[model samples]
Target chain A: DVKVTQSSRYLVKRTGEKVFLECVQDMDHENMFWYRQDPGLGLRLIYFSYDVKMKEKGDIPEGYSVSREKKERFSLILESASTNQTSMYLCASRLAGVGELFFGEGSRLTVL
Target chain B: EDQVTQSPEALRLQEGESSSLNCSYTVSGLRGLFWYRQDPGKGPEFLFTLYSAGEEKEKERLKATLTKKESFLHITAPKPEDSATYLCAVQAGGDTGRRALTFGSGTRLQVQP
Candidate 1:
């Protein structure tokens, strides 16, 4: 079984503060992703990394950025936290080009 | 581009009552469709994956059926522990190496004991 671990299960940040959500996958998967889930919006991809040092923006990537310096770790960075950015963030990993995604427990952010 | 839409924003069922959820999708070409169960404040857990039309997969009390443009998740003899938000996602053949799954809003099922 594949395991994806997220650093923070919950976080509260003030407006304009920066936030970093970290994720690590045990399996040697080449694809990793960050997504934010909202009540009516579903899971919208924020950023995805195909491999180390490579990244692609998803549908709603305006306020976020990502880093994949190594094969097993991917990080999501919020340049400036805002109330609108408060939501459950999920990290997922999969083998390159195929297979089901293994997800982390998710990081819930609350920005005030 | 690929798109997915799940019907019935919410559902309430009594124990032993059976129900089904619908997922409608449109994509240039279909690769695979996935079903996931999500609990409140938690990430989605994989349930089943269907590759083509007429394909079916079962687990415990849940069954998932897939077609070219739609998929159905049928719950039989539900229990209270089965309550959760069921999410549907799809991978498009035309996506090439992107490997991104487009997800729907999900159906929240509440099974009462």
Candidate 2:
């Protein structure tokens, strides 16, 4: 079975503080993604990485950045957290050419 | 733009009741349609993947069918444990590099005794 693990399941940060969410996958998948899920807006993509040290901005990448220095790890960075940034963050990974993704348990971030 | 929408933001059913959830989509070219079940506070769990119209997949009491413009997830004799948020996503054509998926708001179902 494929497994994806997030560094934290819940986090709280003060406004303007830097925050980092880490994700790791054991399946050696080539594709990884970050998304923030909201009540009515659904899951909106924040960033994705296709290979080591490579990344792309998704639909809502503002105030967020990502790092993929290693194939098995992906990190989402909030340069300066704000209250509006609070949401359920999810990480997913899939093999090359495969359409199905395996996701981590998710990290719920609270920016106060 | 590519998009996916799910109907019946919430549904309540009695145990042993049968019903279907709808997922409507619009994309330039469709590669696959996916169904996922998500428990509260957890990520989605994959259920089925339909590649073309008339294609169907099943696991236990859940069945998923696909058409040109939409997909349906039918639950038969559902139990209380079946209650969860059902999500639908579409894989679009073009060099997305298998990057991202467009997801629906999801249909939350509750099954009672």
Candidate 3:
């Protein structure tokens, strides 16, 4: 079974502070994704990484960035956290071209 | 744009009752369609994947069938533990390396004893 792990399950940060969310996958998948889930809005992609050091912006990428320094780890960074950024963040990984994805437990971020 | 939509935003059923959930999609080209189950405050757990129109997959009490434009998940004699939000996603024709998945709003199921 594929296992995806997120560094934190819940986090609280003050406005204007930088925040980091870490994700790791044991399956060595080539694709990693970051998504924020909200009520009525569902899951919206924030950023994705296809390979080490390669990243692409998804539908909503403002105020957020990603890092893929290694194949098994992907990180989401918030340049300046704001109250609007408070939401449940999910990380997923999968083999390139494969339709199935393994997801992490998710990080619920609260930006006060 | 590739889009996925799920019907019946919420469902309630008595134990031993059976029902189906619907997922409709529109994409340039279909690569795959996936089903997942999510519990409260947790990530989604993968259930099944259907690739072609006539394909079908089954796991225990749940069965999934795909047509040209839609997919249906049938739960037979559901139990209380079977209650959860069912999500559907589609992988459309684009960059294969990207592995992007477009998901629906999901259908929340509730089963009572």
Candidate 4:
């Protein structure tokens, strides 16, 4: 079975502060993604990395950035946390070209 | 643009009651349709993947069927453990291929014991 681990399960940050959410996948998948889930909005992708050091912006990537320094690790960074950024963030990984995604437990961020 | 829509935002059922959840999708080219079950505060768990119309996959009491434009997840003899938010997603294939999935708003199911 594939396992995706998130560094934080819950976090609170003040407005204008920078936040970091980290994810690690044991499957060594080449594709990793960051998504924010909100009520009535479903899952909106923030950024995705197909390989180390390569990133692509998704539908909603404003105020967010990503890093893939290693194959097994992906990180999501909020340049400046805002109340609007408070939501559940999910990390997922999959094999290249495979549609099936194995997800992490998710990190709930509260920006106040 | 690739899109997915799930019907019936919420459903309540007594134990042993059966029902179906619908997922409608539109894409330039359909690669696959996926079904996932998400528990509160947890990530979505993959359930089924339908590749083409007339295809069906089953796991325990859940069965998923696919058509050209839509898919259905049928739950039979529901139990409290079966209660979760069901998510539907679509993968698009075309000249502009995408690796990320387009997810629906999801259908929240509650089974009463």
Poorest 10 consecutive residues of model 2 chain A by lDDT?
A94-103
Task: At residue A83, give the lDDT of candidate 2.
Answer: 98
Q: Determine the iRMS, in angstroms, of model 3.
A: 1.4
Residue A16 lDDT in candidate 2: 96
Per-model fnat list:
0.56, 0.74, 0.60, 0.70
TM-scores, each model vs. reference: 0.97, 0.98, 0.97, 0.98
Query: Model 1's CAPRI class?
Result: medium
Name the top lDDT candidate.
4
The superposed Cα distance between candidate 4 and the true structure at residue B87, in angstroms, equals 0.4
Candidate 2 ranges beyond 4 A from true positions: none
Best by DockQ: 4
**Decoy 1 TM-score against native:** 0.97
Query: What class would a CAPRI assessor give candidate 3's docking?
Result: medium
Of the pair 1 and 3, which is ahead by DockQ? 1
User: How well does model 4 score by local distance difference test?
Assistant: 0.94
Candidate 2 displacement at residue A108 in angstroms = 0.6
Considering only N, C-alpha and C atoms within 3 Å, which residue pairs clash in candidate 3?
Answer: none
Give the per-residue lDDT digits (tens) of candidate 3, residues A1-112. Answer: 8999999999999999999999999987989999999877778889988888988888899999899999999999999999999999999999876668889999999999
Q: Per-residue lDDT tens digits of candidate 3, residues B1-106? A: 8788998999999999999999999987798999999999999999999999999999999999999999999999999999999999998876743368889999
Provide the global lDDT of candidate 3 against the true structure.
0.93
The weakest ten consecutive residues by lDDT in model 1 chain B span B91-100
TM-score of chain A, all candidates: 0.98, 0.98, 0.98, 0.98
Deviation in angstroms for B16 in model 2? 0.7
For model 2, how does the per-residue alpha-carbon lDDT over B35-54 read when each residue is reduced to its tens digit? Answer: 99999999999999899999
- How large is the C-alpha RMSD of every model relative to the true structure? 1.0, 0.9, 1.1, 0.9
